[model samples]
Target: MSEVTTPAMRARPKRYLYIAVLIGLLSFLAYGATYPSMQAEAAPGTQASLEVDVDLTEWELNPSQFDFQQGDTVLFNITNSGRFSHNLEVSNTAQHLNSPTIGAGETTTLEVTLDNSGTYTIICAIPGHSDLGMTGELTVSGDNPAPAEGEFLGIPAMRLSPRNNTAVVGSSQEVRVTLHDFTLNADSIEGANVGGEGHWALFLDDELIASLGEPSYTLEGLSAGPHVIRAELRNNDGSAVEPALSSEATIQVPAAAP
Candidate 1:
């Protein structure tokens, strides 16, 4: 018996063809989605590179100068070509970067981002290393300008003893900040004369921690890291002086022995 050709029968085969095509497109899309990621994994992009070879015999660093663009990702490759061990420290008032101590025939890498454009000082953190001439310079060019000196009220001036970016962590640090053109009087701080200082406010990492009449203080309980100590001159009324005469120092703290 011969079957009759119906319009519905013809439509059924066309529906199956559409469904098959749809699935093929879905599979192609899934495969295409992973292509870029696979390509990226195969070949990564390169930024800027800096290579430094250190020798303790001469107490000198090769390629004493490095330059880069601000906001660029830079890879610092350091190799201790000398027999003695050495570490690297790059720091400024706002940030600090360091390399672990690498022994002779050892190489290390430090990835850094120069967030701002300025001159950065590099030195060996090992005791007496920097004095022996293990130092270098880094210059980053960018649109941002270097920080200007903070304005002061009257003749206010503050100088931190031992300076900033010089302290070691896990050790007792004695900080003496001398303030000129103002007298420190904590008792009568409230409503004190403008030029005559009351008590000084101490800030660590921008957090107010102490208000003391003396120009000296002891730093403790600091974890292993870099810290910024700031001192501000206040009026007798305990209010911050106008234009804010302040001084800040960055201190590096090392990890304590376990």
Candidate 2:
């Protein structure tokens, strides 16, 4: 003889099954709340491979300004169109990239990987070439945060003392300059092109007389006549500041006592 199974006994097993399922679900929810998901993080900025054409001529580089994102690989197709041998050099404090010298009517390629973001000096490596204006600028932007207030981002303003139409009573004169939104980084002179930090180039009668890392300089051996003095902001690599921030003053130096 077999014993009959009660309805309550059967319902007890169903309740136990439901309770086990509920407990498992609650445990899963708790674990999810405590730990973060194991998903892959996104990359910062997107990198790009680019090709650019550059024309080299006497004391000039066509397309003098360049813009690019950081971590870019740029292949420069350089052609010498002038009647001289020229080579290209791109440099900053962090890296230096150069190309072989190519003669007129010749062509070459330079591959550069811009890892850092800032300003880089682009110039012809030949002697006296950059002085004659065979220079350009390469600007690399990154995903870095923006600069705070009091940080320079554009061209600076300059003013020279001894305002125009002033007279001095000697063969030497002291000129003082005032600058705004700029810093003179004497340590990095001729090193690399950094943003917002550089020295000043002093020009007397349209000729470069000195590169000043300070604000005041004295002029000696001056002729007894009117002279024009100009102060121009320059980059660390000796390149002219963009938009050309400069101040000019004309003064008369009287003859010395005889």
Candidate 3:
């Protein structure tokens, strides 16, 4: 016996087919929206955009620390969300890509390549900006090249201790400097290097404060605020080294009582 065909049966099959197609289309749309972000996170050197957000008033940076791989080309978009203009610079390393001074609420794009692999300090070079805590760090993954013999003018090295930027208000910030392959001598011994004898100059906010034969100095008479301390290896005649071998640290003094 032949079975009778019903319109309802045909309509139900169509309904299920339509529902399956709808779900497939929705899944494709969702994947398309999320795929780019996933790809960026998984691939370190992929073509992507990295953002650095800065707030001068609060002296804070978003994503204050980031990781980079050697040979990676990244587009950095630095945004100044504060009320003042600011610029960013990388210090204590040979890698040299920077953003210009960006005005308040303005954004700047900087394309940079990570050629060297090492820990780098990121700071705003606006004199007192770094003192207010506008700083961060970048950790790059790869091998950093070493200088060959005679490639350097002198055996020059420096270090700053108590590197963190916190200190008591109205008190002297004591900084210690360590030198390697370089000598600290008195003014009587300043000028050309004889037996590697030289001296060091202490700078506060880029201003030369004192020339010392010893490595320790007290930063005194500073108001309660952030300050940048720098130590430069100099020739006996008070001449700066070629390209300047130096080390720096930032200290923040707590506000004193009224």
lDDT of 3 by residue, 1-258 (tens): 999889998799899999999999999999999999887675644544454444433475665687877666666667888887676666443443456666678887767666677776777655467788888887878886433323444556666643544343466877677665666778544556664567888888889898988888887878777888888877788887665787776777777777
lDDT: the better of candidates 2 and 3: 2
lDDT value, candidate 2, whole model: 0.81
Candidate 2 lDDT, tens digit per residue, 47-86? 6679999999998999789999888999999999999878
Model 3 lDDT at residue 47: 41
The residue-level lDDT of candidate 2 at 238 comes to 93
Q: Tell me the whole-model lDDT of each prediction, alpha carbons only.
A: 0.71, 0.81, 0.69
Stretches > 4 Å off in candidate 3: 1-57, 93-98, 109-112, 125-133, 145-184, 187-192, 195-234, 237-258
Task: Give, for candidate 1, the lowest lDDT window spanning 10 residues.
Answer: 145-154
All models, RMSD in angstroms: 10.9, 16.5, 12.4
Model 3 clash tally, residue pairs: 3
